[model samples]
Target: GSASGGPDEAVRQADRLAKDAGAPASGTAAAFVNAARELGMTRVSLATPYDEAQTETLAGYLRAAGFDVVRAVAGGPASPAEAAGWNAEAQAKLVREAAEPGPDGVLLACTALRTAAHIPQLEVAAGRPVLTANQVSVWEALRLAERRVREPALGTLFTVLPPVRG
Candidate 1:
């Protein structure tokens, strides 16, 4: 879910709220960017279940975080329930389609889309890292806790330890 204001401000507000609450938080977009950075990705392509404008907002967020948004595409179920209905094959196809040659990695955005089961296959097809919302959330949570465990089935993010943040 997106906040009311622009992407950058939304992120800042979220962080501030989390800090005020004395809790750690990693927004999905931030987690996606972190996952991309950990995988050594500078250029990224995004695929989402939102319309073009929403997709561009996410791309803007990534750009604000210092990534080059090489490409962004959106075309999936219109609602969360519809996205949740997508199967692994459909999700894989969406990622693959967004895996245009320019990006070092692809970001499958949308927490509603189930992608934990197909990331490996999607990465192979894209020949690069594939970061998804849910996957990166898990990754950032583990990194916040300062724990790293290898779970190869979840794809490369799980295999590499997150970089230490200063």
Candidate 2:
């Protein structure tokens, strides 16, 4: 069953489970926010493959995490399979289209969408950092494990060290 109170409840449940298992708790939502903060991104544009409602929820989550979502565009894909089928060029176009003049970064917000292959191109086009869900997840996992690895082809998120969190 879905969490009764949306993302907040989902996070709480994840924390509970992690504690029960004697492990650190981490969620993709928190990872995304932390990644953005690490990059010093205060404002961002969002590109998602979800419908209007899901997109709005995602934007709200980002907002609650302290990001200013200056622009948001949804591709309205009917299913995850459709989202995954989106090619690099199409995804780059969506990122470019959704990007505004002053956002600190552009976020491609779905793990289902094929985004990693095009992150470099998207970052160049957007003229800022471009973070995809899968990329951030990997980064966060490494961070939680106290491991640091740098691979430039994966984009700045990997190439640069994450900021220290108190």
Candidate 3:
């Protein structure tokens, strides 16, 4: 992160990962916001493993996309294996600690965080729409999933609210 934390480089990397994940591209915070708002969201928080500067730049991009930046959490361990195994109790505590109340959508980011399992509970605890890295991953590629894959365990988005009519 060049203190500058190249947004272009970051987006390029995200684009490659989206391809690898079999997801659509537009692969930046703006793309994310558009897709999310498609599902009725306006406010979001970030959860990622980066130094402060990189996290802030991401926060900036989201804001540019018209998303309200509720919070920007920086640095979680670097990979999915590491993130998935994170103590749920501890992670919950961290989320509670880092979270700041706002218009009602807490985003549990980090494509590696494997947070779907916790979304429902988090929403109950936080009292809002809870978005996670994996959820967004799927939403960003509903067209790819092909058949309808909505389920209660997936969070309010698929399990509950109607998808954005665009």
Candidate 4:
């Protein structure tokens, strides 16, 4: 069955490791949630290459992190290698199909999906911001490091600075 709390725990563990290593902690899950919030996105659609259970788990994590997952679609790839080989056209098509009405953004889940290469096109096709796991991870790392995000090719998520920390 799909479960929750794993992502939250992962974030906690990353922070703990960073502290122990005497380095700045970069909480990926928290950073993803904050990225959505910074973009004024409270609702999002999701596309993944995992099976149903994994999709459900990811949706649950996103919901727990605060965004309402309005829709989620799984591509059900047989292997990570196959998923990684999925062309940008296929990825964009899946994203478009999963993009239902009322979603503030579209999330192309799974780092193995090779989504970073297609984020700009997907965003334009979906008419909204498109986020991928690797993209979000990089964004979070930059934000936690107090660096400005400015990669226009990665879509709007990288165009603006993260919310100023107090």
Candidate maximizing lDDT: 1
What tens-digit string does per-residue lDDT give for candidate 3 at 73-124?
7755456677666665645655664466664466665665656677777666
Which numbered prediction scores highest in TM-score against the true structure?
2
**What is the Cα-based lDDT of residue 64 in candidate 1?**
79
Residues 1-166 of candidate 4 have per-residue lDDT tens digits of: 1234656686777768888988766554555676787788999988888888888888888888777899999888547888888898988888887887759998887667787766899898788898887788788777668787588998889887655678
Residue-level lDDT tens digits of model 2 in 100-159: 766988888888887777788888877888999889988988887888888878888988
Which of 1 and 3 is ahead in TM-score?
Answer: 1
Candidate numbers sorted by TM-score from highest down: 2, 1, 4, 3
Ranking by lDDT: 1, 2, 4, 3
lDDT against the true structure, each candidate? 0.81, 0.80, 0.61, 0.78
For candidate 1, lDDT tens digit of each residue in 1-166?
2622545775787688788878776577778877898899998999888888888878888887788888888874359999888887777777778888669889988899888888898788777788889999899888777788799899888888556689
Model 3 TM-score (2 dp)? 0.68
Candidate 4: 10-residue stretch with minimal lDDT: 1-10
TM-score of each: 0.88, 0.89, 0.68, 0.87
TM-score, structure 1 vs. true: 0.88
Candidate 3: give the clashing pairs. 49-75, 50-75
Candidate 2 residue pairs in backbone clash: none
